[model samples]
Target: MINKVQILSVTLPGNLDAYIRIANLWPMLSIEEEKSLTQRLRYNSDLDAAKKLILSHLRFVIHISRNYSGYGLPQADLIQEGNIGLMKAVRRFNPEIGVRLVSFAVHWIKSEIHEYVLRNWRIVKVATTKSQRKLFFNLRKTKKRLGWFNEEEIKIVAKELGVSSKDVREMESRMAAQDVTFNPLPEEDFVDGKNNNTIQYLQDKTSNFACRVEKDNWEEHATNKLSNALLGLDKRSRDIIYARWLDKNQKNTLQTIANNYGISAERVRQLEKNAMKKLRIAIEA
Candidate 1:
């Protein structure tokens, strides 16, 4: 049995160096040892078997965490998330899966870290759709230059990631943009010639009051315009727009709505487009 205290005591000075050292220590289990341990956990619900499997794979998690350091998250936190993923993989692993534990565990580990990166990388999530997630990962690998992807590169990425070219371009634009703080700079507004932090800059009473009033006025005008525009719409058109666009879980698609009204899908599309254009113009006016 490996000494838990001894392993805990061997902390390398730096995170990357620590992970590298841990990677070198990943133990190789024989075929019989691997099969026996997996069976014990899978069939017998053996806690000890699960612990042994997790303990042996800690080094692999460390190795995997090193690859994600470029995402700018804390190394220790990434390693911890990877460890949690490793445990999940161990729990769900089937002995009949006919693959090594390490191979199956890699997906789980990376999934956990990828989720962490997406959630924390920006104030809002960078990758929300399936295509965006594919682009998010592949873009990191396929990118060779600092600027946007060219036409040829976009085609290549779309084919490689199994997404449309338009999706690839949109995701590329999103990845290139950086998140900026909403508040103003400290040096831009100073009192008594004293320097202030961003927190202090936000404390300016006049600026905060003006911003709140502006936002309130905008919302009031927008709401009133929307009400007026909807009133101008015929009853059926208003119902269709409300059902398809405003409802939380409405079950009306263009084809469904067309069938209900004995109209073609093209006609439905045209109506929907005209309605949207009118709504936009009304709100802006």
Candidate 2:
């Protein structure tokens, strides 16, 4: 068996030929050998056993990472990410589970590669939420043809995936979209002298320094006035306002506040309305 240093010396190759040559060095492990090594690592924390387990699986990582080549990322990077997942799987593997390590590790391997693709595939993130991520990965596999899905096809996919048709359409659009550089090169000029790049045209005018300063000053003044008005209120009214609005995590409903104060919900509502009126008057004054 190859030692840890020998295994570490092996570098991921740029071309297929070199990769194949390096992969040939690490032989696959037999079932008995694999079980023994895993058991040693699990019971004794044997570093050598863990090293052998990981080394034997490096070729498998290469094989799995190749499936993600369509994402336009470097194959070496994908394999590197998959190797991380493989090591994690090795650490968590149970020899008594009656499953081959490869069978269990495949999920971990693909997940790392998938995360890498999602993170680096586009300049802007295509999928942020759990449902969006599910839609993003499954959309390609579910498509019958190469082109965009038609209206009927979209509905079928939406129903099958338990998401809205609008969400399906949005994910399809995102999948079809390509990343564009935020700033264009100097030579990439339009027919007119003005640059046509998004950076030049898409800037938010309201985000200018002077405008931001003016907005901040107005907010500060309003906040100061509100604070003074709250101080002028009676204790009960102040507490009600705090519980209902000002407390970030504990905004109480009218019924809850009423229960606490031994009053009806309607009475609480009336007091809240009256307090708000007083606040408006105080701020205006």
Candidate 3:
């Protein structure tokens, strides 16, 4: 058996092509040989056997890591993370289960790459739910063929991806949206670094300021119309309406207004109701 310490001392090539060549040159172990090494490491804590098992499996991690390079992360870092996951899988592998290590370790390998992509992709997380995650990873492939999804395309994608049409539309909007700076510049500020441009941090597309302002303006206009409608009521009706809603304290109810005006509660309620109808009509008009 090769000495574990000596194996660690030797520098492994970082380049993928060279590592692939080295892994290809390693002679494939028979089942009996693999089982024997696994037993020695598992029972006797034999470091040399564990080292051999890990070295033989390095090629599989490299191959799997290549598929995740589309996420714009460094290829070398992705492979390194995949290698860590491979080591973890090797430690937990049970040769008695009658499965190849590659098959079992593929899950572990992809899991690590997925975590890496999520962590580095944005300052804010993109996907939290399982369905959203599947959409996040697979939606790119579905959208690659066309410019954007039509209604028919959205339905097909939703069925194929196992998500709701609403969820697919949400993810589509998220993907199409670009992150803008919180304090976006006028193109002149970027020419020189004098601007304290730290607000160039990532902006949340879901909370657009323009949309919020528009909503606020609409609410303010509706409130003004309501105030105007109340002013058109008779003095007593208007007083009763103000006491019910706009008074700061000791807000008068129908009984309280009736006591103040020496009228029955039913009469006070009638006046309030009629005032409300007139206000609604005025606002509608």
Best candidate, lDDT-wise?
2
Cα shift from native, residue 81, model 1 (Å) = 1.4
Question: What's the count of clashing pairs in each model shown?
Answer: 0, 0, 0
In the range 115-154, model 1's lDDT, one tens digit per residue, is 8889887787889976688679778777745346789979
- For 1-285, candidate 2 gives per-residue lDDT tens digits of 224323433356668567766765888999999999999988887878888898888889888887778778988889888888887788889999999999999989988888898899888999889899889878877763546888998898899899999999898888888877667776775537766577766767656898789999999999999999999999989989999999999889999999999999999899999999999999999
**Candidate achieving higher TM-score, 1 or 2:** 2
Residues forming the 10-long window of minimal summed lDDT in candidate 3:
1-10
TM-score of each: 0.58, 0.66, 0.58
lDDT of each: 0.78, 0.85, 0.79
Model 3 lDDT tens row, 193-223: 6763546665777898988999999999999
Query: What residue runs in model 3 are displaced by over 4 Å at the alpha carbon?
Result: 1-20, 181-285
Q: How many residue pairs in model 2 have overlapping backbones?
A: 0
Candidate 1 global lDDT: 0.78
